[model samples]
Target: MKKPMKAALLSAFIFPGVGHFLLKKYIPGVILAGAAFAGLYFLIAKSVETALQITEKIQSGEIQFDAATISELVSGQTAGAESQLLDIALAVLLVSWLIGIADSYRVGRAQDKNVDASD
Candidate 1:
């Protein structure tokens, strides 16, 4: 396979910025990996907190186990401000992931171009 495609696939499927690592772009690879990990951590923690809150509400009879209520909880509308923060965190995680993929792809392509030009 082509170098760029290989790097892109590695970044997309394995870890964010792995393509940069493969191309010996250490600083960017580390930065992207760190940011992606931080975003993922925030998202997971918020999701767990939301899930625990929902469970507590259900057990305490504060919330009903109906479709609409469940929908609201899942949508984070009825949960309050923390839920809003969770939504923001989730969006950040997604955006970061996408950006990581796109950046790695671009870097890989550029490295391939440089290699070709030098040949």
Candidate 2:
């Protein structure tokens, strides 16, 4: 609705930090998006790698996956506490992106809504 918000939203459509760029909050937006990217990358690739390794082991009769989960999707099997933080990072990025866009828009809107306010 506002310029900043619009920009932030548009930026999110590109990556997750574009909104921050539009809002002029470069540092936090970058950190948030970078962290999200790292998390998502590890989650997808790590899970796929783990699955492949497990599959090979099973084929060779060397190891077997647990019975608790059968899907073997990419969302699971990514270990480490940093990864756990990925979820939070992703959330922060999304929220920050949205806020940046929204705030920018609102700020611009407030400054310009009145056609005669600045005269």
Candidate 3:
């Protein structure tokens, strides 16, 4: 396969910055990977916090240990500012992933052209 397509596939299937790394673009790779990691960390942390809160409520008898009640609690937790923050985090991850793929592909294409010119 072409270098550009290979780089794009690496970024899409693997981590966000893998393609950039493949293209030897270390700085962009680090930046994209860091942004993706940060977003993922926030999302996981928030999910764990929500789970702990629900567990505490269940243990305290504030909420029943039923699927419906748990679902309702989860739904309630995703509201207003927190929901907005979660959305932003998701957007950040997505944007970083997309940028990594596109940029890596572009860089790879350039390298391919350079190789062709040198040949």
Which numbered prediction scores highest in lDDT against the true structure?
Answer: 3
Q: Give the per-residue lDDT digits (tens) of candidate 2, residues 46-119.
A: 55777787687677766556554334533455558856665665666566556545554564466456644858
Which has the higher lDDT value, candidate number 1 or candidate number 3? 3
Clashes of 1: 0
Question: 1-119 in candidate 1: lDDT tens per residue?
Answer: 87678777887888777877887889988887887787788877767877888888989999998888977886763367776776777777666667767877788788878888999
Worst 10 residues of 2 by lDDT: 68-77
Question: Would you give me the overall lDDT of model 1?
Answer: 0.78
Question: What order do candidates take by TM-score, descending?
Answer: 3, 1, 2
Question: Each candidate's lDDT (Cα)?
Answer: 0.78, 0.61, 0.93
- Taking all chains together, the TM-score of candidate 2 against the true structure is 0.49
Candidate 2 stretches greater than 4 Å from native: 61-119
* TM-score of each model, in listed order: 0.73, 0.49, 0.94
Which residue pairs collide in model 3, if any? none
The residue ranges of model 3 lying beyond 4 angstroms of the native Cα positions read none
| Model 1 CA deviation exceeding 4 Å by range | 61-68, 76-84
lDDT of 3 by residue, 1-119 (tens): 99899999999989898998888889999999999999999999999999999999999999889999899889889998999999999999999999988988999999999999999
Worst 10 residues of 1 by lDDT: 76-85
* Pairs of residues clashing in candidate 1: none
